[model samples]
Target: MITLGHAQAIIAGAIAHAQNAALKPLGIVVLDAGGQLLAFARQDGASFGRFAIAQAKAHGALAMGDDTAVLAERAKGNPVFFGSLVGVFDGGLALSPGGVLVRNGDGAIIGAVGASGDTGPNDADAVRAGIAAAGFATGAAA
Candidate 1:
């Protein structure tokens, strides 16, 4: 279960990681297993669009039960379906590479974390740092 504290911890850790890496100001979003937003934060200079992109990426991760980067790779093989899904879901799904699913030691999904306002790899790394800091595992497959 993802309590409020857990959500906040994830966001805080992600933000810290971003700052430590000297990355751009980032927007971070946390979502529960049900795909509901649990917590969110935008850094001082983060762009307005970062919030939506971060949320969409996290939502996409939770929806597909996989990392957003994996989904993005899969989308490349089936653009039509993925493109249609964007329209169907009111653009709530993003196949970008900034989303990471949060899991437990037993590998059960608890939630997701997403970051934006930097390159895809940097965003993903920040999210991973947060999940690790919160004592949770990341759902991205090896």
Candidate 2:
């Protein structure tokens, strides 16, 4: 099991990166492999709506066993399936391009992280930095 401490560290690192970059405040979420929440943070001035969007992004990555970017692309080809999921999840099924899966040394996916309130590329960059800071490998999802 990935420790909560690691999750917290990843979130903190992401927050620091965002601060240093002067990016807009963000809502970040980390979820274990089982798609359970491990850690979360909402920077001051972040949108309240982003709280759920961040979790959805992370959960979508964990559920798909890949990064949200790939899932977003897949959604483009199968909008009905992906769109239905949003309804089923009651808006917690974000297929954005800002979520990343975290893998352990043995290449086992341990969790996923998601960020919102910045552009998709910037959000992805933050997640990558956080995953790297946590000492985990970031696998390409696409």
Candidate 3:
């Protein structure tokens, strides 16, 4: 279970990493395994579009059980199918980057973290750092 404490820690860790790296102001979203929003925040100066993007990125990862980067690749290879998913999901999915799954000791997915405001890789790095700080395992790269 992803508790409030865990969510707060995840956000703090992600923000700390982004600050340390001098990345742009970020918006982060955490979601439970069932795709419910757990915690969310947007740093000062984060863009208006960041919140939704971050949420969608997390939802996309949760829905597909893969990171957004992987989804991007899959979408690129099969635009029709991926596009259909986008439509079916009502635009709640993103296939760029910045999303990662959170797992427990048993390797069961417990949650996800998604971020925006930096480059795709940077966003992903922040999310990974956050999940690590929360003492959760990250599943496969996808």
Please report the candidate that would top lDDT against the real structure: 3
Residue-level lDDT of model 2, residues 101-123, one tens digit each, is: 99988888989999999987788
Residue 55, candidate 1: C-alpha displacement in angstroms: 0.6
Cα-based lDDT for every prediction: 0.89, 0.86, 0.91
In model 1, residue pairs whose N, Cα or C atoms come closer than 3 Å (at least 3 residues apart or on different chains), thus clashing, are none
Evaluate candidate 3 by giving its C-alpha RMSD to the native, one decimal: 1.5
- RMSD in angstroms between candidate 1 and the native structure over all alpha carbons: 1.4
The Cα error of candidate 3 at residue 92, in Å, is: 0.7
Q: What is the TM-score of each candidate against the true structure?
A: 0.95, 0.92, 0.95
Candidate 2 residue runs with Cα over 4 Å from true position:
140-142
Error of 2 at 101 (Å): 0.7
- Return the clash pairs for model 3, or none: 67-142
Candidate 3 structure quality by residue, lDDT tens digits, 19-50 = 99999999999999999998999999999999
